[model samples]
Target: MSRRWLLCLALLPCAAQDVIQDWIREIEQSGGGQVLIARAGYDAEANEIRLAPGTTRPELFAEYLHQLAFVRELMAAQALTVSRQTPEEGPLHLILINTARIAGRRDVEEAVIGHELGHAWLRTLGYPAVAAGNSVANCLAIHATDAVQHILIRKELRRRGIDAETPWIATLNDALDQWKVRPLPAALTPCERIQTASQWVDVRLGLDEARWPRITGYEAQLKTRYPDIEQAVSGLAAYLAGQDVAEKEVNRRALLEAVRRLRALAPPTTPLKTNQ
Candidate 1:
């Protein structure tokens, strides 16, 4: 067995302890740590968020949820909101980020970055240049793109000896680690189950097979459904996916441009407000 896995196994129990409490304490205090969790319109009383009962690790899951909300609010404050109701020209708002389960160990950062990329990638798929945020198809696409992002940057991840999966995995060994634990209707329908399982399998297989790039197979799937988009956006996704920490890198430029385009395309936010 790999030393990394062994170390992780040994650490899981400690991880399950007092996660939500720690997060509450951190965000409640003022300083960089509080900055980590706070944002406009975020009601700490209501929005600090909690892991549902089914999550494999409530502490880790809750901590990552805090980061997810932080990132979403950060982007909005910066005017990079990812959508409009339709492609026909109107107020472009933020993309609706539907949460999906990662059945593997990729970090929350990768998941966040990959999801935004998913929104951009879908635009090219002609999945309706607008209205994606609200669509059922968008549900699976979110996980699909995150899976693609991991395939792209995982080499850099491993080269640094960083575990490609989230470190929190070290803490949770059971169903609590699985996912949302859902909504008022927690049960997924038959189709939702298939979509969920398909994505989970995609990332798990992609992570296990070191030599195979999952994007190749994913591209074939995309090509089948949206041939035109497959030709246009795959190059862009590849360009952004290949980024490293090097200065003035081409992939970095591509990444910036992709984000810039999304931001530029967004509609001006209507000045609005209220307590949640």
Candidate 2:
């Protein structure tokens, strides 16, 4: 029994290693061996992104690199390249976004960059181009981060009886952190779950109305079947854009119902593990 237990313990690390190796192998296949991500010349700002040398775990850096590589893979899949000094439109400049002010805040870094990346992907797919500050663009930004950070910030502000319209950087910072770690409950339906999660942002920023059309427009692009829930929440975004709170509420309730239907159709849970 002791030897068997020891063997199990030994196998655990091996399993983890195998998983990591499998992921790397997938990355290699996805890139077709043409991907190259290196920490090239650092700017003054990039130098300020201070993770302690040697003390910081290498896994975090590897994960960050993996995301960058994934972006490259995306570009390659589309048959494009980042044009540096040429005015050709294809792939995005593979930039490692590093700013001194952005240090210690991984979520915001992830959200902001992720939003920009979404724009790049969209351009690659060919949509009517809209500027970043337009109603459509803001919705795109929120969606890129999965509406998680905006929803959280709005909730935190409202809980303190603070006006949601106010521009507060500290609040935004905390909200980003919250979004980074917040887990969706397995019990909620995906659309309901996304809407419930994005409620505060929708209410506060008036995203329901202002952003609905754009959000709805994205549904045709989605490969998933939660169309009703997405469309309902998107109406909320549109209403918020129009400052139609009453309509937003109605849509929110409808989205909740749709979520309930989804949950009933499929109970959310992790799959059982099997010893291979």
Q: Model 1: per-residue lDDT, tens digit, 205-253?
A: 3443344344344434434544433333444344444544233243334
Ten residues in a row with the worst lDDT in model 2? 76-85
| Best TM-score among the predictions, by candidate number | 1
lDDT of 2 by residue, 1-276 (tens): 332233224212433333323332343354322111112122456632232233223343334333443333222121112212223422323323333334434333333333333323322323212111222222232232323223333443344333433323343444445544873233543333443424433443534335343333233323143444455455444443443222434334433333333333333342211111
TM-scores of all predicted structures: 0.31, 0.24
Clash number by candidate, in order: 9, 13
Residue 169: error of model 2 in Å?
A: 7.4
